[model samples]
Target: MKMRNLPPLNALKMFEAVARNSSFSLAAEELCITHSAVSHQIKLLESWMGVKLLQRHSHGATLTPAGQILFTTCVQLFNSLENCINDIQQKPINHGITLGAPSSFMANWLISRIESFEEKYPEIQIKLMTSNDFKLLENEQIDLQILSLNRQVQLKSDLVKIHLFKDKIGPVLSSEKAHNITQPSDLLTQTLLHTESNKNAWSFWATQHQVKLNEAKNQRYFDHLNLMLEAAANGLGIAIAPEILVEKQILNGQLIAPFGFTDSDAEFTLCLKQNCLKNSNLQTFIEWIQYQVSID
Candidate 1:
């Protein structure tokens, strides 16, 4: 994996930017160059290789079959170089730690508490990514990840997982709507709000409370948890949400949980690769997370 025979650095970077973003104009903006300059670089590369690498459409540039092959090779090249640099460094790879978290977790927990982590480790930069699917750790170059383990998750890697905290969830409603939900059976009388995006939520909560859901009675559904919370805040209906995400709202009296319903529910975990589990930089992150969980 010697870099001695590689193509020009500028060309490789331009190719990657366009490939990753799929637009010459976007690549130009990212590289601080003009769109025509990006096109010129691609043209030179195409002439050298004697192939049409990209299919330019009105919307964006898509990789031609040849471009797809080249892009795949470049991604490997970058990953290998990253691994090599990490292995060569004598210290705990501190400059950057790439992270992946659930969108629900990001919107609720991580974003709010991020300033503290940054203040403590200002020298160690972080790149945050979000996905509801926690399985991104299997193939991605993620240093750490967080996920809700309410259900059995399918993943493809051998990982060292640390359980962070269990989510205590119950129905949240506006003060006005709270009147209709006197008991579990009264849930049927109200305008049931839900997140159809999370397939297991409603059914699982129903099973936990020993109640059946008349799906037909559901009045509103949203894809994102934050949106559902907003709807409930506006007196839309009762929303079943984790206490961790809505703690600020609950504390401020914007919402209410009239019935306490956390009855031996499933949990979420904050996990990392075991080999680097004791890395000083990552250890700082782990300690901070554990402190929050402990106090809660």
Candidate 2:
């Protein structure tokens, strides 16, 4: 679309700001210019159209009939331009799959193995996005997700799920903290860190081991699994997390699972929109994830 015999684009933009704000001072602040600069643009725009567009009073300014019409048009035009720019920015630069998953899973498990996937499929770029909301997948904002299913997940008809691995739960703490723990009952004496989402982690582990915890002496609750693990590593308290997620920390002696690991009802799964299966990049990611889980 072309604007023939229209005022300069910058003048129109300044006019739109002033007209919408109803104050030259506010328009100048928003446009990062002096109030005189805003007044100059408005004068230039009025001269180009040969008609006054704004009514100025000692109190403030009000849009004239012509200004009201132009303001509405400018709003729609600017909004459309913004949407176009967003669409262009989101377009993938190379053949790739955007994988969305929980922040903790990305930090603990996927970050370590991402290089291996890259080596296997150098041409296929993998974009990792941190997300846990299913709405993002439904909206097609992300290509795939790796999530732990705490209960039976009901997916939309157009989505599919692939089993990854069962979550292994246990009490993990720093090496220093583990040294004092000789038996399962000893855990009750130390501070207990709980993941806010997985409130029953300690109770489940205790029940599996046939031990009971009388209300913990000190407790800290975290919203994210990574934070809970970090606190555990710093000797703040014992945290219950999937052993698979903390395997690297355990091997490096940063933390230890003194109570051992046990299988939980929760299982990790890769979920993707059905249409994504046709894209070879996403297909490669799905298979690579399965192989990684198998070896883990």
Candidate 3:
């Protein structure tokens, strides 16, 4: 018989279990159905497929040649069905929100205050992913994304950008390591740390301040903003970083800004998918973040 002429899903399920165990009583116990129901389902499956699906012994059943083929196919079919049902029964995006952010924000800022956000919105299970810089609107795969940029992006209808906050950038090093650091030229004498995370960030700041760095001296490379901060804080080298991001460390004498700050190439913004932005959970989070984050 053709495989398409099989019995309903439930009967095929019974056939698979009975065929595998070769015991009607065990199949019944496993399926939580009576022995009669199991026997009836196997009969229906055999008849619908126009093939002998089971060999009747005095106390058990075995698969004939036709039955063996049908049983093998049904095993796969029922197993796939079971997996499909289980996947469907799982959460709606697991009742969670996935967000993307810069590593610096995660380490120095967002991570510090996430406990409050979680407590305020207990219904949501927030999941966070980080990157050195924001992804393109066309390629991003997140519910909500936090991006820091110096320029405004003119995107089409599918993308929406929200201004989050803006901060200046400058060269920061440990004040304890501030010895012999008298002037901007003295910055050349100290270890130079650069975060390659932001695109042309160091160059743009240098251009803004009329300072020319040799560029070859950028000995250290970091994939994320937090590592740059951590390295500078550990007295590994002097790093160019966001002013507000290192404010706490500066107050605690962990890091200090040796020279004045310059405007960043872009401000921190939240870029969201328009369709996902309409989700009530995400909208509430957006409003909460906008309110909590200082936009100035």
Q: Which candidate number has the best lDDT?
A: 2
Candidate 2 per-residue C-alpha lDDT over 101-172 given as tens digits, one digit per residue, 9 for 90 to 100: 776676567755776887888888666666676777888767888788875768889989888888889999
Q: Candidate 2: which pairs clash? A: none
Total clashing pairs for each candidate: 0, 0, 4
Listed per candidate, the RMSD to the true structure in angstroms reads 12.1, 17.6, 19.8
Q: TM-scores across all candidates?
A: 0.64, 0.67, 0.63
User: Clashing residue pairs in candidate 3, if any?
Assistant: 149-266, 149-267, 150-265, 150-266
Model 2, residue 28: displacement in angstroms? 40
lDDT against true structure, model 2: 0.79
| Candidate 1 Cα misplacement greater than 4 A, ranges | 1-94, 151-157
Give the Cα error of residue 233 in candidate 1, in Å: 0.9
lDDT of 1 by residue, 72-147 (tens): 4565466557567878985455567767776566646665466577777788766566544546565556778887
Can you rank all candidates by lDDT, best first? 2, 1, 3
Tens-digit lDDT track of model 3 for 1-296: 65664358788788877876678988999999899999988888777878777878987876554565455455444544544686798723455666777656654666546657788988886666654444633575457778776575675688788987775888888876788788666666667777666647666777776666673344577765556776888888888888767776788687888786777867888877787766988888888787778542
Q: lDDT of each prediction vs. the true structure?
A: 0.71, 0.79, 0.70
lDDT winner between candidates 2 and 3: 2
